[model samples]
Target: MITRRGFMKVLGGGLVSAVALGSYAFGIEPLARLRVARYALTPPGWSPGLKLRLVALADVHACEPWMSARRIASICERANDLGGDVTVLLGDYASGMNLVTRYVHSSEWSKALATLRAPLGVHAIMGNHDWWEDRTAQKSGGGDTFGHRALAGVGIQVYGNRAVRLEKSGFPFWLAGLEDQLALLPGRKWKRAWMGGLDDLDGTLAQVTDEAPVILLAHEPDIFPKVPSRVALTLSGHTHGGQVRFAGHSPVVPSRFGDRYAYGHIVEGDRNLIVSGGLGCSIAPIRFGVPPEIVVVDLG
Candidate 1:
């Protein structure tokens, strides 16, 4: 019943709509929305009278065009305004995941992050990007240690397969942090390892007493299962909420477990997982349904 003219018109309209949608998702939307995803997590064994609020920021791929140093400073100031009791910086400080469009020094970003204020102080863990071999530096035969050292110099405790006990007033809990599991891969290749070189759950949890509530920071959400129930909650970032999501669906989610532990709160047995949608982009600096976020977690 359709003539050639009508069919062409419909097809052209569909293509135009698609282009418009893509432009909004890839460019316009990313610049506009920066969400604050708040959660109240109560893992088993949380103290009855104790409450702790944690502000978590992750995957800050600082670079040009989008994630500039000035933008990083603004994000830090925005986080500080939330007035959390403690702050956790989940890693990926540079924007080298794609083509290395721009190189923002770790120290530059860390100086901005130094402005972050928290009563219990700030804690950080390295993401896979931080451990990645710098192809750009290889041209000059150098290595990358800026992410770790710069954060440390700014008083943000960088934990690699380690745990710390935070005791503020009557509320005391344990916090464990792991190095990027990918860092353990032989030659830092994109290959997988069984129990990997960087992360040591047993080693990190050894310091904590069984009675105390423990919250862990591991960069990748894929390791959510390995976490024991004794540890109350595990916080993670890496998926970026499928970077270019559309119609409430993300086409490209980087995870071995599919979208199982992709984003937001997920409960497994008695343990809990909060995977941040993250701030900034990787591979392509475009975000659709997944807006850059600062996850605020309240624990009681």
Candidate 2:
């Protein structure tokens, strides 16, 4: 049997540890540690003279208590300071989870986004949460342009199942962005479904020249499997790096392929996929081991 003094000591230690952990989760983890995940990719054509710098920010849920307008602006400013040739914003503009949705006007978030600048340009693509958030707002007679219009308002051109050539003076490469796979679904629920009908990969790729290496922007990494080998690299962010990776394992990743494509760089043959840990949280406003990050990919 344990003595009264021993029990009291144990209880005090547990309480202190709990408080410390809670502080880290609610404060330190979510707000701090903006990491720059840099990668160097050598495309098919070996050109030592040409280099491209692409910066990606994913899942910026942009809701209160964690993601505020000032914080968004700061993120943009910091990203600009990184001196990326081109910046890509992977969506999740308005925040929500499960059946509960929170409304933060797109203009508020857009105001901060206008600050982002890159020489090649700032491009964007929608995530499942962006689609769900807009649909949720539409049910209440709000506008359906929260994600799309907001980015466009800030001089960011949004690509939906389309391809564009980078205007930089170098070995030309194509950037293709797919429409949100959940766009066809009728409701706010996000699940793995056969999205072949919704995505027009052939049409998107039609614009690209054969010689150029293709870099695809997709919200969910689950789409990586179907992506052809023609695409040299695919950039994505939707799982939030499992949002709670522990001991190098994330217990609750929303991937059908398990941890294979859950987060970070995944290489299959010559094709590659890089999944960002993302900038904000969903469902719960707390994060454990995974911190928000900006991914910088250097391709030549």
Candidate 3:
């Protein structure tokens, strides 16, 4: 038998603990931290007459109870606030990996994506996760292949080792998009990666004939070495910038090259690479040192 006074004491403690946890879960204390980075790139071919803002969002391992549509909408709302001329979703948006099937179904993605917008246009590509999760239905081509189609239906252009030029004020800016490198098996390739992982800058740039400043959108930033000197800027986000850095630059990362290239802007030679912190969680549904991100780049 328990005493009434003792029961009250235990109940009070439990209530306090529950309140603390509820606050964390509601983001009142922010269980995760998201940081937005600003970058500037000026290539020799860049048009002096044109200056534009490009917003890049990547690695949204969106699922339920975490990166829900409302949360995703909030992220986009932030991008529009940046006043970007164009918005680019750098892939990994619909990662149907792990046990996420329980939380999200294929049909729900299109609605979640409805929140995104770009004055010029929103462009996209598939990520390694999509490949890993889609193999079960690639050939049958049912709901899985529809991922690309859904994005396309929403006015987002999907590119593979191809370049799209956005013309403004008589100056054209080249935006190059590519497939996931991991999607390439020993016999398969990133299509563009046949040039050399994502690093083959010369091959990527060769497709752009105009002197227009070039911006490469490769999902993984570690490929910075292969980017051509001609490329003034490159955007990637595979590392998620550690997404959970413990101390000085997370000692362990999933990249084959290690954590050396985890996050932030990396400059190789004259070109610059910005690795987004990424949104959503992978492997698990929690983030520590890292928070989801939306990046803004000023071409000025």
Candidate 4:
């Protein structure tokens, strides 16, 4: 009784409607909760006895309702489930400190973050957004007001160009964190007189011990070349690893320029740099080919 052309039109319309709704709900509204791990890299010559897992979470702009307290809590629960040796928050904890009250005010995010307990210790380093002069007066590698206190309040050992050593089965390794390379502002000095130009990686390594494998953390992956040979593994989460890599190619990363240092694990000489695609959105909200990630590295 129905005309074939009319029926086809109706079917087409129905499919279009469904796609529209799905896009708005899933992509725009974030109607689905996604949990994924982009295991970065394992340290070469890793000790069989040492089992260190580092979870790197980065670049959660939280500029809009895309991220809420419930979402933050959900992310934390997911991180806890990963079960790692160290949980490292790479930075950009908030869109800005002012929104801290607009979104989560009760320290629930902090408390939920602390729930992520690690033996080697829960460590974090400042991100550019977290330590701007307008945000916090600290230079690169320094902790800002919201980022420093909130993470520390939750028992995360936030660092400013500092290192912490951990021993497993008598095998020692160092975790060194530097201030955000992107956070470098002109005319301000970093604390401890430690942070210098990107070329000063040799100087940075001077303070780090070569007696053991060194794991370096710099917010931007571009600074990979500056890192030293003693650093067997490095964890970074800036550029969001192109935030949307596609077609066997990533978006133009504003940070790293070299061929080997764009995204994922890069073996530069003796150093292995694992750049996490990272969690959360930044600058823009569209993520077509790239999904947010949690980087899990196995030390064993």
Candidate 5:
């Protein structure tokens, strides 16, 4: 029923659109685009008197030609300019993809991150890539990953299943960080029915001594369901907004919950979670609708 000329025109249009999309996803969005996503919320149980602004950066999978040290420093500069009361690094400082001209070393990336500044100081937590990329930590199954040491070396406090009490203008709150939930990879030497995780949500929450509202920093959003009402807000970055999202849906989320916690602000039963789209690629160098971002959360 179709004419040859009409069919050829349709095919040509399709090819052109595909080429444009490919260029934007693989080159423009991944390499050039950086955005600051701002969110303001007053979570239930949060003190009316206390106001906090948090700048969060995550998944800086640093590597050559993509996330170089220079690029990271630029990002840090922008983050510092935001004038947040606190800054949090949500992890995955190591290069996650193998298509790098050269791997940016921990020292290089950490040095760049050292430029980040906040009145309450910069705090960090490790992500799965930070754990899985370290051969020494992976083999031993229970030691500080290279990413952890590098962050510490730069004077950034890295929390591992720990809670810290912090105050802003005489209002106190608790900040808790859980270890990576996907620390150990499966291998012949160590076989497990379930992927090993180092996170201790129960133990970490137990450390919070008082009723001061708690803000939990988890690398992956998979821990959201278990998060109790005790936590005012949960911040995470690991799914990378499924790396290619459209119409508020990410088709291939890395999470066990599928698209439920794929990205952005999600509220459920008085509990709140904000997942960052993050700054770098994961398994592949591609980004589409979900461009790299630095998330700014304003909580009261």
Candidate 6:
């Protein structure tokens, strides 16, 4: 019941809408949009008296024009203003995309992050990109990457399969951090199904001497299934909410479990995991539906 001229008009309109949406996704959302995503929960066995507020920044993928040092400083300032008891950097400080005009160096981004302040302290872990981007670490298959050293140089404690005990208002809890699950790429010399991951979940958890509720920091959420109930919470980044989500569904996720561990707070069998959407892009500078976010978790 439609005329040829009408069909042409409708097709033109659809084309225009597609172009507009693409422009917004490529230029506006990834570059300009910033948000704070908050979650409040009492994990099983969490200390009642110890109210801990944690601000998490993750997958920074620092690059020129999109995520510059000035912008990172601004993000840090916003995080500091939140007054979290502690702040955790969830890794991927290096640019992961080829579309960057200039890659923001690790030193520059780490220095900007140095401004982050919390009464307890700022902690960090390395993401897959942090390891893959560092040629030296990749070649050796097992050493501190530039991202790790840069963060350490800026006075941030970089955790590598380690746990630290801390007390808040006399209430004690342990913080465990695991190394990146995909620390080494599959090169010619190491052609295997597993990518030579450096993560040691059991070893890290074993470091906790007491029964204090532990919060685990991991770069990827793929390790969530193995997390024990002893870990009150597991915080991760890496997936970036598929970097382009829609209607609470990501068409593609970097995680081995696909959308199962893609983004937001996930609870399974008394274990809890929070996969941050993160503050930057990977593979390309484009985002839609999922905006850049700094995650804040309140626990008791």
Candidate 3 residues 1-300, lDDT tens each? 889999999999999998775555345312245567888766556678788888988887767666766667777788778888888877776653464544554456656665667767888766666554665433332233455776776666876677878876666888888666665322233223232222234565678987778888888766677677777788887777665576648665768777767887777667788888788767765455666778998885
lDDT of 6 at 4: 98
TM-score per prediction, in order, is: 0.90, 0.88, 0.79, 0.77, 0.98, 0.98
lDDT of each: 0.81, 0.79, 0.69, 0.66, 0.95, 0.92
For model 6, what is the alpha-carbon lDDT of residue 33? 89
Model 6 vs. true fold: TM: 0.98
Q: Residues 1-300, candidate 4, lDDT per residue (tens digit)?
A: 879999999999999998986575337533244546556345666655666777777766553465666777677778878877778887776664342335544265566566666767778876776655333454334335576777787678977677777776688888888776756445434443343332245555667665777888887777776676667788787666665566746756757484345567777666788877666665655454556666778766
Show where candidate 4 strays beyond 4 Å: 1-33, 38-48, 96-108, 136-143, 184-204, 256-260
Q: What is the lDDT of candidate 3?
A: 0.69
lDDT of 6: 0.92
Clashing pairs in 4: 141-179
Candidate 6 residue-wise lDDT, 132-205, digit = tens: 98887887888799998999998999999999999899999988899999898886755545677899999999
Listed per candidate, the RMSD to the true structure in angstroms reads: 3.4, 3.7, 6.6, 5.7, 1.1, 1.2
Our model 2 lands, by Cα RMSD against the true structure, at 3.7
In Å, residue 183's CA in model 4 sits off its true spot by 1.4
What is the clash count of model 5?
0
Score candidate 5 by TM-score against the native.
0.98
Residue-by-residue lDDT tens digits, candidate 5, 1-300: 889999999999999999999999999999999999999999999988999999999999999888999999999999999989999999999999998899999999999999999999999999999988887787888779999999999999999999999999999999999999999988865554556899999999999998899999999999999999999999999999999999999999999999999999999999999999999998999999999999999998
Q: Clashing pairs in model 6? A: none
Model 1 CA lDDT for position 9:
100
Name the runs in model 5 displaced over 4 angstroms.
190-194
What are the per-residue Cα lDDT tens digits for candidate 2 across 137-160?
434422344788888877888988
Point out where model 2 deviates above 4 Å. Answer: 1-4, 43-48, 97-103, 136-144, 186-197
Q: Is candidate 2 or candidate 3 better by lDDT?
A: 2
